[model samples]
Target: MSLSQSFIIGQYVHRNSIIHRLDPRAKLVIAFLFMLSVMLLNSWLSYVLSAVFVVCVVTISQIPPSYIVRGLKPVWLIVIVTSVFHIFLTQGGQLWLEAGVFSIYEEGVIKAGNIAIRIILLLVMASLLTLTTKLGDLAQAIEDLLKPAKRLGVPTQEFALMISWTIRFIPILLNETDNVMKAQRARGVRFNSGNIVRRLQSFIPIVVPILLLAFQKAESASLAVEARGYSPGMNRTQLRTLAFKKLDYQVLIISIFCFALLLALRK
Candidate 1:
């Protein structure tokens, strides 16, 4: 698939909307808390409420729902695998099916359903953050959040910078892979018209070029860093400052209150 056809996971789309305007730190905190609350939930009603919250946020973000759905397609396999494991391995409730030595229980099915929903919710929430916030903003917010760790000699800034670059390069690597595959195809390399071994071999031609390109990019990045005289633990100035506004606090309060109410209802 071409890069355009590939999923956009960590790329930001500029839009003037409540979600897009919120502070990145607030978005990060809210999404993390929401996912954690979803994990603690034990009822379908709670999951429904979580889903509604996610849909509402997406609507506020002004990002196309189609984009979100397309982005989720890449992760559907993971969600399905997680669901299948839960469905077959978990045991409890009424027996729904029995064939030979295998049996399906009602509780297992319920667990599977819950797991699937949770995975989708987490993906949607995470995608919302990256779709709305810029990578630089996210990195700064993370560094600020982890600033206290600096006192403990934890290299929080480096950690945050590494994470930001990793996220920023996800789309780049996918695009590079697509380009490499196309180039290989132009050279009469058939990636799909072969047996298992042949197909595996086809990837070798594609993988080598991408790896070389990746190393070149990494080396260039390192040189750029040194050219800028970047020093670990040195005081640096930010081009943009992050500050929490009244709207940020209001949204935080409302989200926390709603999530707490849902958790209470689950009891």
Candidate 2:
């Protein structure tokens, strides 16, 4: 697929690779730890190492480089906007650029770079998890993780199902939007070529259809779930239970070690 149309956030690719074979709960925990490590790390080298780790994990997942790059397209824009905000607003350190009514300082640049790096690292890690794991597995993983909360009267299974369904619907909604955009374009509606206000106005047709379709899809899914005897607060059994294997243990141990190493590097 083209970079502009790279896979959606919740789209999954099933492959026989090691990363794909990993237990969803294990992947979920490692993902959390990885993001935590990136945020806690202070040194430049530590950030670089974290970035390298992400690259390595992505490579192991066997997802196409183009797909991963495309997934990052939206994130790059946010990074640029936020980085610019930090560069201009943040102050201190040596002056980098001096201009009337606008000045750039060394600290501002560093801060902007720091924010950009953190955003990219987190997005990459999150995208990797979604791309590699199935939504059903993710739901199960979340429910398993939240099992302890069941004692507190929490509806863990329902909560997990809701979270998974929300994520699972993201790509479906995007697809619906694309179909609406295409239909609108066929009727001579210009979304990209118009001025700011015009462009915003052009989406009026697209938005209505998406909203309707979202409700329609949700209604249909609920009906199907109910037909299958699914009910909130009801205990359920899995066809294939998630069990920690040797490989899973090894991966978790390695993940913990990496986080510990990152923590040490921060000091």
Candidate 3:
């Protein structure tokens, strides 16, 4: 299987740390703010600061760096391609290498470095959120956070439930895909040996079974929810309540501080 096609799913690791104890909503909001700040940054210093911030947050979370990097393996190609294009195609400063129709400039090199750093920082920040927060907790947090949107005529609760279910099922789906691939392999199916078109054709058997199983699971889940008295437009009490603790406040303050610093540095 191609690197991009590999069954890599983000899994939450149980760690007793400040980051793990914070409200999932806080973590999600901080992650979004960090991503926005990183994207807004145009200088290399800002990118470096973002990278440091990511490392610090990951360290505080006590999640293994290996797991975060592993989750990012699928997107490494995209980062590389984007960096290469930025380095070679963008025009600025003195040329480092020049041919009849091609050149590499100093400014492009700096820009590419900044882009690469920002990409890595973004991935790390996202991975940190998934690593420390449970899918169920995240869903609840999202549901609570979106409560305000209900006044705007949006089905915030339903939307939150959808997001929660999707996040909750990602790992399950990945595991299911792995099992399906193994079953196909046992029947002499090779996913990697054929040409592009032939390989795609070979996927039909695998894809069909997965789709059927997904439908089966969906039906079962719907039935279970109905049996539990779940209904649209009805208020539901959650078993676990999300509350912002001292650590959450600390993290929020730090995140806001970092965001402001990043913005100021950008200017």
Q: Each model's RMSD to truth, in Å?
A: 2.2, 1.9, 3.2
Clashes of each: 0, 0, 0
Worst 10 residues of 2 by lDDT: 1-10
**lDDT measured at residue 214 in model 2 versus the true structure, 0 to 100:** 94
Error of 2 at 41 (Å): 2.3
The alpha-carbon lDDT assigned to residue 46 of candidate 2 equals: 92
Candidate of highest TM-score:
2
lDDT for 61 in candidate 2 is 94
Query: lDDT scores for all predictions?
Result: 0.87, 0.88, 0.81
Q: lDDT per residue, candidate 2, 1-267, as tens digits?
A: 332255457888777789999999999999999998888878899998898898899889998877777887867778999999999988999988988988899999988988888988898888899989999999999999998999999999999999999988888877777888888989999988868899889988787788999999999999999999988777899878999999999999999998999999985
TM-score of 1: 0.90
In model 2, pairs of residues that clash are none
Query: How would you order the candidates by lDDT, starting with the best?
Result: 2, 1, 3
Cα lDDT tens digits, model 1, 1-267, are 466344676789999999989999999999889989998998878888888899999899999999888888888878888888888888899988988877889989998998899888888888888899999999999999988888998888888889888888788888888888888889899988869899888898777788898898888888899898988777787898899999999999999998997798685
